[model samples]
Every structure is written in C-alpha cells, then in structure tokens.
Target: MGEDCNLHEQACAAVLAPGVAVTLDISPKPVRAMTDLEFTVSLSDRNGPVDGAQVALDLSMPGMFMGENRSILSGLGNGLYQGKGVIPKCPSGKTLWRGDLQVQVGDVTGNVWFLFSVK
Candidate 1:
C-alpha cells in the first residue's frame, strides 16, 4: 500500500486564512520650525480612538547627537488627539533638528519623521 495520508496538513490549511493588515496615518505633513509641534493620527480600519496606545518621540540635531525629547497629548473628543512637546536647542553645536514619532496600538504601529530648524 503506497498512499499519502497527511490529513493534518489539510486540516491546518483549511483553518488558516489571510487576515487584515495594519497601517499608520499621521496628519499635518511637512512640519516647520515654530513654538510647538502638533499632529494627529487616525486608526486605519480600526473603530475607535485606540485608547492607551503608546507614542514614542525622538529628536535630533544636525551635526550633533540626539537630545532631550518628550511626548504630551490632549484629548479632543471623539477619538481625535492632539499633542504638544518640547525640543531642546543648543548653540554652537546643534541648530537644525529633526523629530521621529512612533505610535503603537496593540499589533498595529505607525511612524512620523519630520525636520525643523531652530531660530
């Protein structure tokens, strides 16, 4: 008797199916140098504000090592969010700076990278 009997493989294939993919969105692209930096995020294909989602912000300066950075936000009602943070400036060292923003909700994640100069 020469017959293939791999029923387990067939069962596994039947149960497994493709799932939805996660994507990131950030508003106010092409930021500029100013008093404060602000932006918004919309959950792609996800209903709701994605409560308790974690956001990471990093700042760097031209020709200099990265420095002080923080994250703060204000709830704008109905799943909308706004955040304000500080970026440190150094003279004779780093003037122009760039920022990196990372947002994570469950298994989904997003990122924003922007550049700005100090006045």
Candidate 2:
C-alpha cells in the first residue's frame, strides 16, 4: 500500500527535463483555483540570459486526462518571458496543478514543470 501511494504521488509530481537550466516565478503564490495567474520564465546559461527564445506554458493536472490547456508566452526582452493564464477547477477534486514551461532557444529545446497546490 505504501509503495502504491508513493507511485501515485510520483506520477502526480512535476518533472524537469535533463540539461535544462531555467527559473520560473509565478505571481500570487499559493495559487488559487479559478483565478488569474501570471508567470515569468527566465532562461539562462553560463554567459547570461538567453535571448531570442520562444516560450510557452502548459497547465494541467497529473493523472487526469482533461485535454491540454496551453498558453504562448511573449518575450519581455532579455531572457525573461511573461504570460497570463488561469488554473481551471478540477472536477475530480484534485488540488495539485502542474505548469510546464516549454522553451526553445535556437536549436535547443527543453521543458521544466512546476507543481503547486490550489486552495
């Protein structure tokens, strides 16, 4: 039973792809469901913030197939990208939400997922 529970938790957790280096900041922490949410994604490397990159956000709940809720983020100059979105209310009563930031800088592409709980 414990193993099964652990597996479920892991399945619901967010995952970051290897070799991806980026930071994400979500405004209005302690995200509330059915509310407006904003996010900032910063891509960087050894040199500095990565420029000329296309970024997007994919919001979903793990372990549930409710289609894809995605948003295209606009670059705010430098390596920072900003976008606005909303966390839909889960019909299954699950409060865990995952936000996957998809980044494409030149030939390199990667994703980082951030998980948060909704009240």
Query: Each candidate: what lDDT?
Result: 0.44, 0.69
- Write the residue-wise lDDT of candidate 1 on 85-119 in tens digits: 55554656445665555666567565555555444
The C-alpha TM-scores of every prediction are: 0.49, 0.79
Q: How close is candidate 2 to the true structure, as a TM-score?
A: 0.79
Top candidate on TM-score is 2
Off by over 4 Å in 2: 1-20
- Name the runs in model 1 displaced over 4 angstroms: 1-52, 74-77
